[model samples]
Target: MIFFYIFLLLFPHQICQAEVNSNMEGKLLNDLLKDYNKMSRPVKNLSSPLEVTINIGTFESFDLDEISQTISVLLYITVSWVDKFLTWNPEEYSGINQTRLPAGQIWIPDLQLQHTPIGSGMLSTESNAILDSSGLVKHTPPGTIKTICQEMDLYKFPYDTQTCTIEHLSFTHPSNELFLRLGDFTLDQNTFQSQEWQLLNVTSRIEINYYGGPYPFQKHIICLMVKRIPNYYISNMIYPYAVLASVAGLGFTLPPDSADKLSLGVSVLLSTTFYAGMVADIVPVTTSMPFLGLYCLVMMSLVAFSVVSTLAVINLHNRGEAKMSYLQKTIFLKFLPSLLFMEKKSKPSQVQRNTNHKGKVQVETLNDSSKEVEQEQAKDWKFAAKVLNEFCMIIFSAGFFIIFAYTIFFL
Candidate 1:
């Protein structure tokens, strides 16, 4: 019985409270909207400009199109401005401090994107604007922003960092009536929405533009800095090319008479050509060559030279076992062998040995025929060809390394 009595007592109080709350909200809305003009700007003075602030809360989605040189982002945007005509006394209506109203019925800032081709850069969509008793209106609007970033720095290509900016300019209103600026545009941890790009930072700045208005207009510039993840290029393009270069260098170690030496270099050269075209297709047409592209070109050149050197070495080795000239003996036989850490084996001595046949004292002086001496001093093209192959290997390998380092650092 006590519980039943308590319920009956609270029921009437709850009903009265609900009616009071409803009446308070309805009366507040009615009083505020009675004289509100949605088409006119909320500023009371014509000379005082209405300061509007737009802040990027978060990026729901982000994408970059390399071919088109465009970037698309779906951002959670917050717009804030103070309406001088929307103010009221919070003490008059049950101490109500804030309320929400339809955003389409309020005066919104007229801002358009300078680089976008879509319909006017209106961020305000079907949403509610929170109105405080102090005349502060805060609206959170939704839209996908597409902007062109023409000056994309592709010098580094796959390992490149790109910064794209979206400019928001006031179209209809001059700086005297309305001005727009950026709030805290820092991105949160969830800003990384693109698989190929990493969001490093989001920055914004406001500048007064003087293009079309008697008064200077305000423009809010939003800069998004992102770095490309190079894992894909490293795995598919760079690693394979590095392996191919090593294989081509190993071809020098093969004997000049082996058929695989020249063929190996040719194969590597072909592979390098294919990879260079692949890298060219991966990046858009830019004003300057990418570092990786230059690297590929250098590798291609080195591989081609290696093939030519291998062919020459093979030809020299198989030139009918021809005898080497004096210059060839001096350079390839002596100097080159010393320079390339190769040592030539000498012919065995054919001097006669004294035989003690009858236990008689017999001594024989050493003597060598002219033909034997000439044969001992003879050198062939085969050993010279081997030395040339070693020299080519060292040179081409060093060229590959030098070009790789130059492109990596000096692009």
Candidate 2:
């Protein structure tokens, strides 16, 4: 009998609490939907300046195409606004905090990028919008956009800087009807850094223009300045070329008479062609070559010149006295040696014995004297060839140094 009385008392209390909760939820929904006819046009707030705020949620990637001169960026674009008709008082509704409603249930501004090549239409999503008690609505849509990037300067290539922009405006609404202002910041600075590019900064600009008419058009442009990270090119393109250039110089140190000198120079020339092709694959095909490409070209020219000089040295080594000219002898043996700072051992002059029994002197025949002079001339020619090799080494070494220094600091 006592248990039956306790159950009846508790049943009424639970029923009353359920009834109050149900009424609060019903009243909140009824009030929120009273003026929320989605099909009805709200003329009262057409001039209320639908304050739009944009933010980035996730920046996936940014790719640049040199041939087309375009940049493509993948981003999660968030557009927020306040819907005056979607408000409800949380205190009056028993703290019925917020609601998730279909985007078709409310008015949304038609926003689009001005000159975007992709993702230019309405942002369609199966996701719902968050409607708070304060009437604020936030929706994030993921999209990819391809836009023009005419500021890619490849003269420095691999170390170049480029600025790309994204512009947006109301597709259907004019400045008087609707206005878009930048949010607190343009991009999500924490996650905008790219793997291959260092993002410098993002700046926003707004322009209002009227073509001698009553209505004005507003445009919002966001410019992104980015510099490429060149560590990949440095390791694969630059350092390898430097190593090859130094290796080509090693040919000069080899003996001029050896057959390997010409072979080494020719091998380096062929190897440079391979690297040049690799670089050509990466760089844009145009009339102007980058500084790194020029350095490669100059290095190849130097190696080819070294090969030609080696052939001349071999010819000089094999030349007979009859074939060798007097001018060649004077220039290579005297002038060139002095100019190149080379020292040659001087042969002792002929000393005739004058210890005769009765005041007599001894003289060698012309044929014997001519042979000795020819031998000394041959030795001088060989010495000059070696000096020529050393001179080329110095010239090529200096050329390499100048090319590298200029490309590094001047260009």
**Tens digits of per-residue lDDT for model 2, 82-164:** 77777877878777777666666666667676665556656655667777888888877555777777556787777788888
Number of the top candidate by TM-score? 1
Quote model 1's TM-score. Answer: 0.78
Model 2 worst lDDT window (10 residues) = 39-48
The residue ranges of model 1 lying beyond 4 angstroms of the native Cα positions read 1-37, 59-62, 85-96, 182-187, 190-200, 321-335, 346-379, 402-411
Count clashing pairs, candidate 1.
Answer: 0
- How would you encode candidate 1's per-residue C-alpha lDDT over 1-411 as one tens digit per residue? 999888878798887877887899889988888878988989888778899988878876788888788999887778899988888898898788998888887787877788886776676648889999999999888678899986998888778899999888877788788877668665676655777888888878888878855788888888889898878877787667777887888899988878788889988898888888888776788789887777777778888888999988987787653556788789878898899889977766545555687776555554476665445443456777888898998898898777666644554
Clashing pairs in 2: none
Q: What are the lDDT figures for the candidates, one per model?
A: 0.81, 0.74
